[model samples]
Target: MSAKRVDSTIVVVAVAAAIVGAVALLGVLGQAWMGYAPSHLLTYLPMILLPIAFALVAVALVRAALRRRQTEVGQS
Candidate 1:
Protein backbone atom coordinates (compact mmCIF):
# COMPACT_ATOMS: atom_id res chain seq x y z
CA MET A 1 0.00 0.00 0.00
CA SER A 2 0.90 3.62 -0.43
CA ALA A 3 2.50 5.68 2.32
CA LYS A 4 -0.61 7.78 2.77
CA ARG A 5 -2.76 4.73 3.19
CA VAL A 6 -0.28 3.22 5.61
CA ASP A 7 -0.20 6.43 7.62
CA SER A 8 -3.97 6.55 7.83
CA THR A 9 -4.08 2.93 8.85
CA ILE A 10 -1.53 3.60 11.55
CA VAL A 11 -3.69 6.43 12.85
CA VAL A 12 -6.66 4.13 13.09
CA VAL A 13 -4.61 1.45 14.83
CA ALA A 14 -3.22 3.99 17.26
CA VAL A 15 -6.73 5.07 18.18
CA ALA A 16 -7.77 1.48 18.71
CA ALA A 17 -4.70 0.76 20.81
CA ALA A 18 -5.44 3.79 22.97
CA ILE A 19 -9.00 2.64 23.51
CA VAL A 20 -7.93 -0.87 24.42
CA GLY A 21 -5.33 0.48 26.80
CA ALA A 22 -7.98 2.55 28.51
CA VAL A 23 -10.24 -0.45 28.88
CA ALA A 24 -7.39 -2.47 30.32
CA LEU A 25 -6.59 0.28 32.77
CA LEU A 26 -10.19 0.44 33.81
CA GLY A 27 -10.22 -3.31 34.32
CA VAL A 28 -7.24 -3.17 36.62
CA LEU A 29 -8.51 -0.20 38.59
CA GLY A 30 -11.98 -1.65 38.88
CA GLN A 31 -10.62 -4.88 40.31
CA ALA A 32 -8.30 -3.10 42.72
CA TRP A 33 -10.52 -0.29 43.94
CA MET A 34 -14.07 -1.52 43.44
CA GLY A 35 -13.68 -5.26 43.95
CA TYR A 36 -14.97 -5.84 40.47
CA ALA A 37 -13.50 -8.75 38.63
CA PRO A 38 -12.08 -8.26 35.17
CA SER A 39 -12.07 -10.72 32.36
CA HIS A 40 -8.81 -12.41 31.37
CA LEU A 41 -8.98 -10.86 27.92
CA LEU A 42 -9.10 -7.36 29.36
CA THR A 43 -6.17 -8.06 31.67
CA TYR A 44 -4.00 -9.49 28.93
CA LEU A 45 -4.78 -7.00 26.17
CA PRO A 46 -2.12 -4.45 27.02
CA MET A 47 0.60 -7.05 27.01
CA ILE A 48 -0.39 -7.82 23.44
CA LEU A 49 -1.04 -4.29 22.27
CA LEU A 50 2.00 -2.41 23.56
CA PRO A 51 4.61 -4.32 21.60
CA ILE A 52 2.53 -4.41 18.45
CA ALA A 53 1.86 -0.70 18.59
CA PHE A 54 5.52 0.03 19.25
CA ALA A 55 6.62 -2.04 16.28
CA LEU A 56 4.03 -0.53 13.94
CA VAL A 57 4.91 3.01 14.94
CA ALA A 58 8.60 2.27 14.48
CA VAL A 59 8.02 0.84 11.02
CA ALA A 60 5.76 3.71 10.02
CA LEU A 61 8.36 6.24 11.09
CA VAL A 62 11.06 4.49 9.10
CA ARG A 63 8.84 4.25 6.06
CA ALA A 64 7.91 7.92 6.27
CA ALA A 65 11.52 8.94 6.60
CA LEU A 66 12.46 6.86 3.60
CA ARG A 67 9.61 8.32 1.54
CA ARG A 68 10.68 11.83 2.49
CA ARG A 69 14.26 11.09 1.52
CA GLN A 70 13.21 9.72 -1.84
CA THR A 71 11.15 12.81 -2.56
CA GLU A 72 14.05 15.05 -1.63
CA VAL A 73 16.39 13.11 -3.89
CA GLY A 74 13.93 13.36 -6.79
CA GLN A 75 13.57 17.07 -6.24
CA SER A 76 17.32 17.58 -6.51
Candidate 2:
Protein backbone atom coordinates (compact mmCIF):
# COMPACT_ATOMS: atom_id res chain seq x y z
CA MET A 1 0.00 0.00 0.00
CA SER A 2 2.14 2.84 -1.22
CA ALA A 3 0.98 6.40 -0.66
CA LYS A 4 0.31 6.86 -4.36
CA ARG A 5 -1.85 3.75 -4.54
CA VAL A 6 -3.83 4.80 -1.49
CA ASP A 7 -4.32 8.28 -2.86
CA SER A 8 -5.46 6.95 -6.23
CA THR A 9 -7.98 4.68 -4.60
CA ILE A 10 -9.32 7.49 -2.50
CA VAL A 11 -9.69 9.75 -5.52
CA VAL A 12 -11.51 7.08 -7.53
CA VAL A 13 -13.89 6.25 -4.71
CA ALA A 14 -14.63 9.86 -3.94
CA VAL A 15 -15.38 10.71 -7.55
CA ALA A 16 -17.69 7.72 -7.95
CA ALA A 17 -19.53 8.54 -4.74
CA ALA A 18 -19.94 12.13 -5.79
CA ILE A 19 -21.36 11.12 -9.15
CA VAL A 20 -23.85 8.74 -7.57
CA GLY A 21 -24.90 11.40 -5.08
CA ALA A 22 -25.40 13.94 -7.84
CA VAL A 23 -27.53 11.57 -9.88
CA ALA A 24 -29.69 10.68 -6.92
CA LEU A 25 -30.15 14.32 -6.06
CA LEU A 26 -31.15 15.22 -9.57
CA GLY A 27 -33.62 12.35 -9.89
CA VAL A 28 -35.31 13.30 -6.66
CA LEU A 29 -35.48 16.97 -7.46
CA GLY A 30 -36.87 16.27 -10.88
CA GLN A 31 -39.53 13.96 -9.52
CA ALA A 32 -40.52 16.38 -6.79
CA TRP A 33 -40.81 19.17 -9.29
CA MET A 34 -43.19 16.95 -11.19
CA GLY A 35 -45.38 16.67 -8.03
CA TYR A 36 -44.30 13.28 -6.70
CA ALA A 37 -44.29 13.03 -2.92
CA PRO A 38 -42.26 9.84 -2.59
CA SER A 39 -39.34 11.51 -4.22
CA HIS A 40 -38.98 13.64 -1.10
CA LEU A 41 -36.98 10.92 0.58
CA LEU A 42 -34.66 10.67 -2.36
CA THR A 43 -34.26 14.43 -2.42
CA TYR A 44 -33.34 14.74 1.26
CA LEU A 45 -31.05 11.73 1.44
CA PRO A 46 -28.99 12.85 -1.51
CA MET A 47 -29.06 16.47 -0.41
CA ILE A 48 -27.29 15.46 2.78
CA LEU A 49 -24.98 12.95 1.12
CA LEU A 50 -24.12 15.11 -1.85
CA PRO A 51 -22.30 17.78 0.12
CA ILE A 52 -20.34 15.22 2.09
CA ALA A 53 -19.48 13.32 -1.07
CA PHE A 54 -18.37 16.53 -2.79
CA ALA A 55 -16.29 17.48 0.21
CA LEU A 56 -14.55 14.14 0.12
CA VAL A 57 -13.83 14.54 -3.58
CA ALA A 58 -12.52 18.05 -3.05
CA VAL A 59 -10.26 16.92 -0.22
CA ALA A 60 -8.88 14.10 -2.35
CA LEU A 61 -8.16 16.47 -5.24
CA VAL A 62 -6.47 19.02 -3.00
CA ARG A 63 -4.36 16.33 -1.39
CA ALA A 64 -3.25 15.00 -4.78
CA ALA A 65 -2.43 18.49 -6.01
CA LEU A 66 -0.42 19.27 -2.89
CA ARG A 67 1.45 16.01 -3.17
CA ARG A 68 2.34 16.75 -6.77
CA ARG A 69 3.60 20.18 -5.80
CA GLN A 70 5.70 18.74 -3.04
CA THR A 71 7.21 16.15 -5.35
CA GLU A 72 8.01 18.77 -7.96
CA VAL A 73 9.68 20.94 -5.37
CA GLY A 74 11.71 17.99 -4.13
CA GLN A 75 12.89 17.26 -7.65
CA SER A 76 13.93 20.85 -8.26
Which candidate tops lDDT? 1
**C-alpha-based local distance difference test score of model 2:** 0.76
Off by over 4 Å in 2: 72-76
Q: Looking at model 2, which ten-residue stretch has the lowest summed lDDT?
A: 67-76
lDDT of 2 by residue, 1-76 (tens): 9987887887777777778778887887787788886466676767777677778778878988888877755543
Q: After superposition, how far is residue 18 of candidate 1 from its true place, in Å?
A: 2.9
Write the residue-wise lDDT of candidate 1 on 1-76 in tens digits: 9769979899679778867877786787788687777777878887788667777788778888888877765544
Q: Which one is best on TM-score? A: 1
Screening candidate 2 with a backbone cut-off below 3 angstroms (N, C-alpha, C), the clashing residue pairs are none
**What TM-score does each of the candidates earn?**
0.73, 0.67
